[model samples]
Target: MRFTLFISAILLLGCTPKDTIAIERQLILSADFSHYDNFFPIQTLNLIKKGIKDKIHIMYVCFDPGIDGEKEFPGEDYMDDFSFKIMKDGKYQPTFDKSALVIGNDFKEYFKEDFDSYKKLKAEGNISRFIEMPEKPEWWQYDQTPKNSKGKPMTFICQIDMGRIIINDDCRLFVFYDQDDRMVKYVYQRT
Candidate 1:
C-alpha cells in the first residue's frame, strides 16, 4: 500500500500543474518589506525615491520570518502605512503609488517624467539595461547550509535585495531579493 502511494506521488510530481506552467510576464521588483516598523532604517527606500529617471514596473515580494499572518502593505486605505516614506524638506508628502509598499520614490518619478524615453529606447532596439544594485545589505549564502527533503546538508546560495533598516524601534524598512547573489551578505535577515 505504501509503495502504491509513493508511485502515485511520483506520477503527480511528473505532471505539470496548470497554475505552475503559466508565466507571469510582468517586470516587477520583488522585495520583502514587512520587517521594518518605522522610518529610520528606510533611508535606502527614501533615497531610491529621490533617484530613478523613468517609470519602471516593480514587483515586491516580502517574507516575514517571525510573524505568520498576512502581511500589511500600503494602499488606498490609510495611505501612510509603509516601511518607507516620502519626505520633502523633512516633511512627508504623497507622490507615487503606495499600493505595493515599494520603496524608491525616484523610480516612480522616472516613469512619469520620461514616458517616451523608455519607449524610444525600446523602439531603437537597445533595451537590455541591467538595474544597478546600490550599496546596501543583502542576504548571505555562505553562512547557511542547504538541506534536502530528508534534512541532510546541501549547497546554499542567497540573494538579498534589502533588509531591516531601523532608525528606532518605531521606524524601519525591510527589503528582500528575487535572485541569488552568492557573495557578500550583510544586514540580511536571517531566516
Candidate 2:
C-alpha cells in the first residue's frame, strides 16, 4: 500500500529523469571542493542554494581558468584572481559557524555574520543596505530554453548573473544531480 502511494506521488509531481534526483542528504555541509587552501576564508563563500524543502546549503566557488581538471589553489602568495581556491586542510571546518553565513541566518552579531557583505553595506561611513541571499538556482528559468539532442539542461556559454560573494560577475553556480553519489553537487562554472 505504501509503495503504491509513493509511486503515485512521483507521477503527480511530474517526476522525470531530470526532475527527481534520489540522493540521501545529510544534516552537515559535506561538500567536495576541487581546490585546497588552509586559510581560504570560507566564511566569505557564497551560499547559493537555500533549501526550501531539504534545508540544504550549497557553497559556490571558482578556480583558475588556466588550470585543467578539478580546481586547486596555489600557495598563500598567489594574488588570488578568480577566488576558486580551497582551505589548507586546517582552515575548513565541517561544523556550522553562525558568523560565517552571508544571509539566511538573520542579521546578528554585526560584521561577523556578514563578513563578506560588510564593506558593501557601508557607504562612505553611512549604512546603505545589506546584500541578502541572491535567490534560488535558475533551473526553472533555464527549463524554458530548449534542451540539446541528448536531453541535457542547456548550458549557457558564459556566466550572466553575478552572485553575492563566491560567484563573480561572469560566474554561475549550477546544481549537478550526482546519481551515483546519491547527493546533489553544486557546480561553479564560468559560462
Please, what are the lDDT tens digits per residue for candidate 2 over residues 92-116?
2222222222222232232233334
> On residues 1-191, what C-alpha lDDT tens digit does candidate 1 reach at each position?
74555345324323211211111112111123223221111111112232321222211222222322233432321222222221222222222233333434445443333333433443554232211232332333323333333545422111223221111112111232111221111112233
Candidate 1's TM-score = 0.20
lDDT of all predictions: 0.25, 0.28
lDDT of 1: 0.25
Clashes of 1: 22
User: Total clashing residue pairs per candidate?
Assistant: 22, 6
Give me the candidate number with maximum lDDT.
2
lDDT (Cα, 0-100) at 173 in candidate 1: 18
